[model samples]
Structures are given as C-alpha cells and as structure tokens.
Target chain A: MNLVLRAACVYMALLFVFRVAGKRSLVTVTTFDFLLLLIISECTQQALLGQDYSVTGAIILVGTLVSLELGLSWLKCRSTRFERWLDGTPLVIIEDGRILRERLAWLSVDEEDILEAAHVQHGLLRLDQIRYAIVERNGAIAIIPWREGG
Target chain B: MVEIKRAGDLETSEDLAFERTSRRVRRVARSLLYVFVLLAALGLFGDGPLSHARAGHESGFFVRYERFARVDGTTRFQIHPHPGSSAAPRRLFVSTSLFERGHVEQFVPEPASVEIAADRSIITFPRVESGGFVVLVMRPLRPGALRFSLGEEGGPTLDLALFVYP
Candidate 1:
C-alpha cells in the first residue's frame, strides 16, 4: 500500500514536471538532458522505495506505475482535448515564403531550425522554395514544397 | 529581425486549420496546468510538508500520534498501535520537527534503542515492542506540522499541526 501510494505520487510529480518542461526539452535528447534524466531516475528511487526494500514493496511500486500509465493512455483515447493538451498541437511555422515568427518564438525555435529541417528533409536549398514549414506535435519539423503547376 | 508576414494576408486554408488546432491545444494545456496545480496544492495539504511526498497512502497497522502542537507549549498525546497477529514490539520513528530542541516529559517510557539526529529534531526507535498505548508529553521548541513516521523517514507519517504562539 505504501508502495502504491509512493508510486502514484511519484508518477504525478514526474508527469507534471515533464509536462511543464515541454516536449522540446526531451525530444532533442541532448547529453545534459540525458544526465538530468538519469539523476531524476536516481532521485525517484528513494522516494518510491522509502525505507522498505522488501520484494512486495518493489512489486507494488512497479504495478502501480504501470497501471497509472495505462490509465492515462485510456484517458487520452477517450478525450481528444486531453490528448492534444498532453502532446501539443502541430503549428505552421512558414506559409508561402513567410515565417510565423510568433509561432516559432513561442516554441523557442528559430529560423535556423526550420531551414535545417527543410534542407535535410526536402533537400530544398532556398527558404523561398518551401511553401510551408511545420512544427509537429512531436517537436519535429516538416517542410512542404510548392507544386510545379501551382 | 526575422521577417514575419501578417497572418491575415499570408494565411492559407491549411494555416488557418493549424492555427485553430493550436489555439484549442493552448486552451487545453492551460486548463490542464491549472488542474494539476490545484491537485498538487490539495496533496500538499493532505500530506505533511515533511512526509517525503510518497506516491502512496498509508496502509497496514498504524499508530495515532499527536496531530497538533504549539511552539514552546506543552502537548500531551497517546500513540495507540493497532494490534495484529504479531505481538512483536513495533519500532517508531519520530522525524517530527517538534522534537527539535524540545523536552520530552519525564514519564515517557525510555525506548530500548534510540537515536537523536544531529539536527536534534529527528528521533528514531530501533526497537519498541509495546503494543499498548504509549503516552508522550512534550514541550515543543519549534512550531509547524511535525512529522512522525511508524518505521522510518518516508514511512507512514502522521503530521501534527503546530501553531506557534508569540
């Protein structure tokens, strides 16, 4: 029971923290972020186990975490807005050779990021050649080029 | 400065769709954040500040310790350990800040094995087998919710609200 309680509390805390930190902080997976993630895992260990290292306690903790995650998944499926809130919605960074500066700034992203994605993904040399650049919900950039006829 | 075109002239059908969706997401995210903050506040209120923020609630046999104390004031409380099949003496750990610099009454039983942490607030009982009521009277030095756990720190804690009187 203590284990379950600990697991639930830890899960809630971690979830809120991750949410506030934003997906960009995680998706890139920089070396510093990796270290930070490791340290967070280490810190949560004591909070979850507490003074009890019994096998029963370990089982309860693991079970509770898994159950909570599964429950969130179920909640997400049932609620579209919840899914969007948790994962964020995709945004148009560029439309018809014009950059959405406000949108990019809101995400802490710059023109260089979109250009890099454009160059790498679409092999487009010039920014004007691209009709649209989008910041996906998963923090990846997607570039769309203007069609030959249009 | 990065060149940014006005949304009114530059936005296409696709851009409008993305903007609408993003606005919905922003609203949802704000609401979610507010909800989470409220939940966190409620949890902090329900659990003691020094309870180590465990993910679970206390289950199993527990002892009811003093739930309130005052700074520089006398408090008398009884700990009644719920009986179980095992009659073994249960160890009690009082990580309570109330014990810091406070004086335990003379009548309180001497714990078989005890340790007062360096900060002087945390008290540990290595072995306490008494299944009956153990009454404790103390004159607390500090005020605030004092955390007393059953086994050890991060264990099941009973927070005693303390209000200091000037």
Candidate 2:
C-alpha cells in the first residue's frame, strides 16, 4: 500500500513540475539538464524504496509507476480536452516568412532556435525560404519550405 | 474556435483562444511556485524556525523536541531531569508508544538499564548533580501525529506531540 501511494504521489508531483517548467526546457537538453535528470532520479529512488531493500519491494514500485503511466495515457486518449491540457497543442510561430514575435516570447523561443531547427532539418539558409514554422507539442519546431515552383 | 487553413499548400490547425488561456495559466502557476518556496523556507514544511519546540514544567523537568519531523529523518530529543536536594540516581518513565513509533539511533549519557513494562519503559540513570541531561537521537518510523510522554519516576511528566511528515 505504501509503495503504490508513494509512486502515485511522486508521479503526480513530477507531472506538475515539468508542466510548469514548460516543454521548451526539455526540448534541447544541455549538459546541465542531463545532470539534473540524474540527480532527480537519484532523489526519487530513495523516496520510492524507503528502507525496503528486498527485490519484491523494487518490483512493486516499478509496477506501480508503470501502471500509473498507463492509466494516465488511457485517460488522455478518451478525452480531447485532457489530451490538449496534458500535451499542449502545436502553435504556428512563423507563417509566410513573417514571425509572430509575441508567441515566440511566450514560448521562450527565439528566431535563432527556429533557424537552427530549419538548418538541421531542411538545410534552409534564410527565413524567406521557409513558408511556415510550427512549435509542436513535444517542443520540436517543424519547418515547411517554399515550393520549388514558387 | 479553431481555424483550419492552408499555409503554402499545407493545412494547419490553430486555436488562438486556447493558446492565450494556457499562456495566462502558466504565468499564474509560476507565481504560485514562488510563494510555495517561501513557505517551505519559513519552516512550514519542517526543520526550520517553526519546527523547534520546547515543553516542560517548573519542577526542573524540561524537554526540547521538534514540533514537526520527517519520517526516517533523524531528530534530537533532549530530556533534563530535576536533580533534587538528595543525591540519588533518578529513573525516567517513558511511554512505550515513543519507542514503538520512533527508532532510537543513539543515546547520550546512556541509561544504566532499561526495564520494559506493559505500557511504559523505565530507564535508570547514574547519579548526577544539577544541569545533567539525556539526549535521544531518534528517527520517526511513521508519518502522522505521534504522541508520547516522558518524566522522572514519581515526578512531573511532560507530554510531547510531534507531527511527522512523509
């Protein structure tokens, strides 16, 4: 009982914290972000296990966390409102070579980030060469280049 | 309402209203987080100014303990026994509930002997003068309200309560 409750609480807390942190923070992982992830998992491990060192305790914790994740996913699939709230809808930040400065500021994204994604994904050099740039729900930028005929 | 239109021949779906509302909600959430951190720092969570507490009586019996403690986190409980005019060793009676719920890690000025009774544990201390104290380093095993009592045998008993956080 304690094991399941601990796992559930930890899962809910992590979900709220990461949601508040915004998706862009995790989109690009820096060296410090990787270290931070390691530290968080270390702290979570102690809380989940408490003093129970037996293999059964570890198995129970793992099962509890996995079950919680499956339940949340199922709930998300059933309700579009929940899916939208849990995973934010994609926003178009750039259209027809014009940038939406306000949306970029709100998302903590900049022109350089869009251009970098463009460069890596499409090898495009200038903003004029792109028709649209969208910030996807997973925080990755999707770029559409102008038609060759145009 | 959402608007679906073509951007350079590729269809796009955008909900400007939802985006605006979500941005506002995130702003509020960040502001609340700052307040939460401030409260935790003020000892509302534990181990801060509000957590330190003391209880005792005028009979020279006193105890220092934490009003709020964390499960599995070590905390100190100091007991001061009144050294009367007579120079005889003192015996302390502690409720068994304390031992049952708290794991004693160490004891200062170790008791000469511990005799367990049905409801309480009697700890005998060596003869001492005034200003002598016994310290119990304990880690609470469970979370929630922990109630216990301690005092010298045939003397005043001080009841202590601690709220343990998980």
Candidate 3:
C-alpha cells in the first residue's frame, strides 16, 4: 500500500513537471540532462523505497509503477481530451512555406531549428522549400517538403 | 521535406506519427536502464534505501552499515547483543580513513563512553540494561571508505566499512 502510494505520487509529480517544463525539455538532451535525470531518479528511489530493501519490496515498487502506467495508457486511449492533456496536441508551425511565428514562439522554437529539422528529415534546403512544419508530440519538429511539380 | 497539398486533409500521418512516439518511448526506456545500471554499480539498491539487512548477530556481534555514504551526512548504525548484561564495557578502537575523528558524533543511551583518539575512537558500553542498545551517529570528514572495528584491526568481530561521497 505504501509502495502504491509512493509510485502514484511520483507519477503525478513527474507528469506535472514534464508538462510544465514543456516538450522541448525532453526533446533536447545534453550531457548534463542525462546526469540530471540520474540524480532525480536516485532521489526518487530514496523517497519511494525508504529503507526497505527486501525482494518483496522491490517487486511491489515495480508492480505499482507498471500498473499506474498501464492505467494511464488505458485512460489515454479512451478519452481524447485526456490523451491531449497527457501528450499535448501537435501544433502546425508552418503551412505552404509560411512560418507560423506565433505558434513557433509559443514553443520557443526558431527558424534555424525548423530549417535544421527540415533538411535532416525531408531534404528541405530552405524555409520556402517546406510545405508544412509541425511540432510533433515528442517535441521533434516535423517538416513536409514541397511537391516537385506543385 | 516532401509533401502534397494537405488535399483538404490536415491530419498527421498515422503510421509515421506512431513510429516517432514509440521511438521516443524507447529512448526514454534506454535512459532509465542506463541510470539503473549506475545505481546498481554503486550498490545503492542494496545498501541505501532498499537495504533490508537488519542489525543482528549471525555468527558474532556484528554491525551492518551502509557501504556507501555522503560526506557531511549522517547514517545510523544499530547494534544487537547476546541478550545479557556484559558487565565489562567493551573497549573498541575505531580506525577510519573516510571520517574525521574530531567531527564524528555519536548518540547512544546511558552508560556508554566514547573516547576520541588520533587514529581511533574507543566506544565502551558499560553494562547496558537488557533491551538497551547503542546508536552512533557519525559524520564523514572526507570522501572515501571508512573502515573500523570494535576490537583490533582485522581480528575484530564488529568490523564496519563505510564509503563517503564527496
């Protein structure tokens, strides 16, 4: 029961923080980000497990975490709004070679970032070469190149 | 970027979209595994929060300590004896490389005298009543493995090892 409570709290806390931190934080990974992640996990483990290091305690913690995740996934699949809230709806940042500066600013994305993704993802060489640019749920910028004939 | 005019349908590509999300999840899982490996290597799961080893005598009077600790932090060391009044307080010499002897603090019940020395601290328990135990609170002076024993080095039954983090 304690394990379940701890897991639930940690899950909600992480969800809230990631949502508040926005998608860009998770999408962009630096060397320091990896180290920060490890530190956070270490602290979380201490809070979750307390001083109980038995095999049973370990099983309980794992069980609680997996169960909570499965429940959230089930909820997400059933409710579109819940899914949107859990994973923000993707935003279309560019359309027909026109940059949506407002939406791009909202996500703190830049023209350079978009161009970089465009070239790497779809061989788009310039802003005018892109037909559509969307910010995907996972935080990566997606580019749709202009049709050759169109 | 390769595209067709949304054709009046602006919905994202279902297949590629799903792949992107799954790839992200896979990356996250990999990162979690990496951290887990690090924690396991540090023996944190065994000695830190998940430690289930209680303070009890298996062969001789022993102490189970955190093999790893942080400098300037405190850890509890519990002691359980052989259910009787040992009139003579046990004279134990503590030798540690990881902890500063002057900075080491102790908290125990009555009838225990701790003598701080240059290389060791003598912890003597004077006829502790039944059900009474000794609890020592020690602070690390440096970051390394602090080794000590209740008696002579290598021959002491109550030997302990603590690693301090800087």
Candidate 4:
C-alpha cells in the first residue's frame, strides 16, 4: 500500500469517527481533543510507515492519509449535519458592543489574539465598535461592527 | 389574478436556477472524484520501482550533516564516506563562503599544512592525509555550503565526499 493511501485511510477513519462523535467533539478541542489527535497520529504513523521503517513504507502511509482526507471532504459536502458536527457552529463571543471574556477564556484564547483578529478582519480598533464577535469553529475570530442607524 | 400568475412564474424560474446550480456542483464533484481515484491508482500500481530509484539517485552526491555541536564562532565539516568504500587518503579543494575568517584542518596520522591566502576568504590545503575512518574537523568562519575539490589541478581525481556539520 502507498503511504499516502494509508494516510488517507487513517484520515478518513478519523473524520468518520469525529463525525460520529458529534459536533462538540470538534467544536471545542479541549485537552481530550489534543490527546485524541496525538494518539490518532501515532497510530496512523505506524500503519502508514509500517514496522519496517523504510522510505517506501513512509510514502505509502502518507498516500493513505491524503486519500482519507479527500474522501471525508467529499462526504462532508453531502451532509450538512456532519459538516456542522465536525467543523462546529460558530459561537458568538461578543454581543452588543461588550466582550464575552468568559467564552474567550473557555476557548483557551487571549484578548490580544481576538483583538488582533478583529482588527485584521474588520478594522475594529476598539471593542466598543464591535456589535458582535464570533469565535469560528476553525479557530478564527470574526467581529461584526455596530450599525449606525440602529 | 395576473399578479398571482407572475408570482408563480418567478417561483418556477428561481427553482430552475437552483436546479441548474446544483447540477453544476454535482458535475464538479464527480470530476474531482475521478481525479482522486486516478491519483490513488497511480500511486498504488504504477512504476513503484521507478519512484524508489529516482529517490535513491537524487540522494547521491548530496551529503547532509545536521545538528552537530557548533564551537564558538566556528563552522565545521564532518565527512562520512558511503558504506563499503575503500578507506584511502584523497586530496580535497573546498570553495565556499564558509572560510571567511577561519581555516580548514584535517586530523590524520600525518600533520597537514593549511595555507590561507591574502584575501583571507580562500584557503588551500596541498595534501591532507585521511587515516581510514576518522572525522576531519574544519572550522570556517561563515555558515553556508563549502564546495571541496579532492585532487590537484589537472591530476587524477579521487573519490571523497564533503559534509558540513553545524
């Protein structure tokens, strides 16, 4: 088996597992999520590269991983619930021109990081200008500006 | 009644547009699937030996020495010969920016002479003895690839590979 194909297989398996585990599994990657990722990678490494430890084994493993990722993406497009579950629904971190400090801390993010992301995305220089801020599932922060009329 | 009829017609057109968009997306998805399958098939069944051979060929003539201890303000080259080659002394000429401040030294049974030119960047070693399997430490000033030539000018060339360890 090619390394990529093996890697693809492992990746697809992981994606399927995550999808089955529900939206929360991917929504907030806690310490548990990190551990799962590490373990999966370790297992996949052995399966892809094999115990032989040769360059050929390594290539086949990588191929498997790529194939798996492609397959999962295809599946994700066909299912909205699966997409939401794996990718997570974006969480509103700031509302009504007020910072949701609790949610930020919960996501293991700092004020500086959110501020920088907001500034880069929306030219939001101050927290007061932001009507709503969302912590996206893909580990990104988005800020919506306060409307002038309302 | 005419307004109602117009609304129905607009609804039908919107539905048609959605259907067309969906069809285009599905077509793109199918094409992508075919490409992925083709790549997988190629990786599995096509020219496996050829790929390995190519990797091996590329690995030749390139020596990589990584993460060796760096002495204060000195760059070093650690040359290790490929497996199963005869151990013999070969002349070497190194041309690189690495020797900007320092000089090259070879550690063998015999004492070797190192001559740095007036430019201070270029160093010439006439003959450096290699005692079978041993590491030669050369301290060059700069940190980069140092090209080494292994024989006298217009003389029969010998097989010697150069590697830098920083």
Candidate 5:
C-alpha cells in the first residue's frame, strides 16, 4: 500500500511540474539539463523507495507508475480537450514565407532555431524558400518548402 | 493573427487560439515555479536558515532545535539545564512522544541514569555548574508534527514541536 501510494503521488507531481515547465524546455537538452535530469531522478528514487530495498517493493512501484500512465493515456484518448491540454496542439510559427515573431518570442524560439531546423530538415537557404513552419506537439519544428511553379 | 489551414498531408491539429492561451498559462506557471524554488531554497519546505530555531531563555533553561526536519535524517537538539545548588543532581525530563517518534540516536554528556515512565522519561545528569548543557541526537521515524518537551526536574519544563518532512 505504501509503495503504490508513493508511486502515484510522485508520478502526479512530476507530470504536473514537467507539463508546467513547457515542452520546449526539454526538446533541446544541454549537458546541464541532462545532469539536472539525473539529479532529479536520484531524488525521486529516494522518495519512492524510502527504506524498503526489497524486490517486491520495486515491482510494486513500477506497476503503480505504469498503471497511472496508462490510465492518463486512456483519458486523453476519450477527450480531445483533455488531449489538447495535456499534449498541446501544433502551432504554426511561420506561414507564407513570413515568420510569426510574436509566437517565436512566446516559445523562446529564435530565428536561428528556425533556420537550423530548415537547414537540417530541408536544404532550404532563405526564409523566402520556406512556405510554412509548424511547431509540433512534441516540440519539433516541421518545415514545408515551396514547390516549383504550378 | 495569421489564418491557419490544414493543407498538408501530415495528420496534425493546428489550433492557434488554444496554443496562444496555453502559452500564456505556461508563462504564469513558470513564474510560480520560480517562487516555489525560491521558497525551497530559503528552507520553507525543509532544512535551511529558516528551519533553525531556538526556544526558551538561553541564560537559564533553553533548547535549540530545528523547526523543520527530514524523516530518518539525523537532527540534534541542545538542552541547557537550570543551575541549582552545587550538590544537587541536575535532572532533565523528556516526553515519551520524543522517544516514540524521535529515535534518539545519541546523547552527549551521557545521563547518569534514565527512568522510563508511561508519560515521560526522567534523565539524571551528574552535578555540574549551571552553564553546562546536554545534546541529544535523533533520527525521526515518521513525518508530521512531533510534540515533545524538555525541562529540569521540578523546574520549568519547555514544550516544543517540530515538523518532519518526508
């Protein structure tokens, strides 16, 4: 009972914190961010396990966390509003050879980020060559290039 | 705002209105996160400058303890016994709740003898000058508010409470 309760509480707390931190924060991870993630996991492990070091305790905690994740996914599938709120929707940051400066600023994405995404995804050189750029729900930028004359 | 259309073959739901509101909410939440971290650093949630506290008159009978402590983490408290006649033994009394919740790990200036009772435990120390003190180290067994007391026998007993964080 203690194991399950601990797991559920930790899972909910982490989920809320990570969601509030914004998707862009983890999409591009620096070395420091990776170190921070490791430290966070270590702290979480101590809270979840407490003094129990048995195999059964570990199994129970894992099961509880997995079950909670599955339950949330099920709930997300049932409601589009919930899905949008939890996972967010794709945002169009660039449209018709123009960059949406306001949206870029809100997302902390600079012109350099868009250019890098454009260079890697499509060999496009200039912003004029790109027709649209969408920031996906998973925080990856997707670029669409203008095709030859119709 | 630019009008967004679902023109591509890729399956994606483009909701600029929701995205805008979500970003605003995210900004607000980020501000809250900053406050939370600041408070934690100041020891509002656990051990820090704010957690260290003292109670009672230090000149006579007093105690120094942490306002906040971690479960299973070692914490130390000092008790200054009131000065009495030179030949009289200095005795200190501790509430049994301290024994139950606070797993007493060590004691400095070991007591000459300890008498366990149903409500409280009486600790006797050899006769010493007035300014001397004793230190008790404890590892809390659980979280939540722990109420305890320490005082010289038949003298002023000080009641104290500390919160243990998990």
Candidate 6:
C-alpha cells in the first residue's frame, strides 16, 4: 500500500471518531476518555504503518466504533435519564465550609487535590475560607469562597 | 453693594456649540498628530534595507551566485548561517560544468558528509537524513560563464554562476 493512501485513510478515521465522540469528550479527559484516546491512536497506527494492515478492515472497524459513539451521544443528549446514566452529574464535596467525606470518596477525589485546585484557581489557601466545592462533570474541582458579608 | 449686584450674562447656545466643536477638533488634531509621528518613525527606521537584511539573516542564510567571467581557477565563496541556526551544522554541495546545453548530470554526495573549510571555499555534508537545508557551493572545474541549476530539498533553487576573481 502506498504511504500517502494509508495516511489519508488513517486521517479520515480519526476525523470520523472525533466527530462522533461528541463535545464532552473534547471538553474533559476522564479515565475512560483517556483510554479511548490511546486505543484510537494505536488502532490508527496499525492501519497506517503496520505490515499486516488492510485499509478496508481498518475502515470497517473504525466506522463501527464511531457509529456506536454517535448513537450513545444522541441518546444521552435527548434524554436526561440516559445522560445521567452515561455521564454522571457533578457532586458537591463541600458545603458551608464542611467537607462531605462520602461524596468525596464516591468521586475518588482526595481532600488534598481539592484543596490544591482551590488554592490554585481561587486563591483560597485555607479550608475554612471555602464555602462550597464541587467535582464538576469534567473531573475538575470548582471552589467557591465564603462571602465576607456572610 | 446692592446697587453693584447687577446681572451676570451667561454664554449663549451658539457659544456653547462653538466650545464643543473646538474641543472635538482639538481631540481629532491630537490623534492625527500621534498617527503622523508613528508613521514618520516607521518610515525613518522601520522596513529599510538594513532591517530586511537583519530579518533575512535571522530567518535563514542568504546565498547568492554571480556569473563566471573566466574559467579553470578556484573561486572563493562564503556563507554565514542564520543567527540562531549556526549550531545545527550544515553542508554545501556543488555540481560544476552543468551549463552545457542539453546535458544533464546526476551528482549525488559520495558518502554524504558536511564540513567546509574555514574560508568556505570547499563543500561537504554528512550522510543524508530526513530533513534540513542544503546550500550548494559550486567551484567551477573550468570557467567561462558557467550556469548551474542548484538547490536543496525543501529549499529554493536557482541557476547562477561564479565569476573568476581578479
């Protein structure tokens, strides 16, 4: 197989995958999303550069994977219940300067990570200064400072 | 004092209008003056030949070849690499006597090495790699206005000459 033709096929496959993966995949890199990214790159490499690779075989496999992703994204976008099932909602890990240990454990986030993110993003150095903290859907920590007036 | 407390006259609407217009004109004049100063500075010091030379040097080496006036003697050529690019180490290749009309010559680097004399009168390069610019340095085997087609891959090519230096 010619190098240029193989390269073009791999490029098209990647484009199709990205389009089907939905906006959330780009916005956030969850553990699952990261795994998908690695797998996709590996698969494309096999198709483009590997000796035993067949362009038609690679295209078929990539097309099927993309179709599945598109179907899931469509379902998740249309139904709130389905979206919740596929993409879990954010959980509040802290409220009114009190840590919610249960929610933190559920999200697999440690207190140190939350504190560091808080200090970095909002300049909230002390735990007592944080009024609210939430683990956003993208796995990022958001911290709200306690109101001075309050 | 009561008799002296007379009425004070305020400026008319026309006067207020004139004052506003004068203020606007003054603002516009100031802005235009700033623009004129900027353009004058640019014209005096910006986009001149010196700046262009500096820019070309900063971007990459400049290579020029003059026509060969006399034949059968070695001519000196010098190439100074672009400012930040001197560290990469480059090569110079040459195919002489290529000006014979309708005669095509294939000259590949023998063993491919890149090292030139301190005076830059010699040409050499290392083993071929995937990328990098090649500067073709021609020393005519025989001189009498020789023209050669020369360029490196991914770089500009031109037909030029090296005249015999008196």
Best by TM-score: 2
Candidate 1 docking classification: incorrect
lDDT of 4 by residue, A28-146 (tens): 46798799889877876665564358876666655555666677578678875555445544556676666767766545566676677778887778767777666655656666777
Fnat for the candidates in order: 0.00, 0.31, 0.00, 0.00, 0.69, 0.00
| Candidate scoring better on TM-score of 2 and 3 | 2
Top-scoring candidate (DockQ)? 5
Better of 1 and 5 by lDDT: 5
Model 2 RMSD in Å is: 2.6
Question: What docking grade does candidate 6 earn?
Answer: incorrect
lDDT of all predictions: 0.60, 0.84, 0.66, 0.46, 0.83, 0.48
Backbone clashes in model 6, listed as residue pairs: B66-B161, B68-B163, B71-B143, B72-B143, B112-B126, B113-B125, B113-B126, B114-B124, B114-B125, B114-B126
Ranking by DockQ: 5, 2, 3, 4, 1, 6
lDDT of 5 by residue, B44-160 (tens): 766778888888986678898888888878888888777667578888889999988878988888879999988899888787666777898999888899999888778998889
Mind sharing the TM-score for model 6?
0.33
Over the stretch A1-150, how does candidate 3's per-residue lDDT look in tens digits?
266787788888778667656677867688999999999999888867765788999898899889989998999888765676577656788877789787776678999999899878887667998888888878898888878887
Model 6: what TM-score for its first chain?
Answer: 0.62
Query: Which portions of model 1 miss their true places by more than 4 Å?
Result: A148-150, B1-144, B147-166
Q: TM-score ranking from best to worst? A: 2, 5, 3, 1, 4, 6
Better of 1 and 2 by DockQ: 2
Leading candidate by lDDT: 2
On residues B20-112, what C-alpha lDDT tens digit does candidate 4 reach at each position?
343454456557666755754453222222112110112222122222222222333333222222433333333333344235564432324
- Residue B160 local lDDT, model 3: 64
> How many clashing residue pairs are found in candidate 4?
23
Across residues B48-163, which tens digit of lDDT does each residue of candidate 6 receive? 22222211232454443233322222232233333334444344433444534212222233424533333222244443343333333333334234454443333444444433
lDDT at B28, model 4: 67
For candidate 4, what is the recovered fraction of reference interface contacts?
0.00
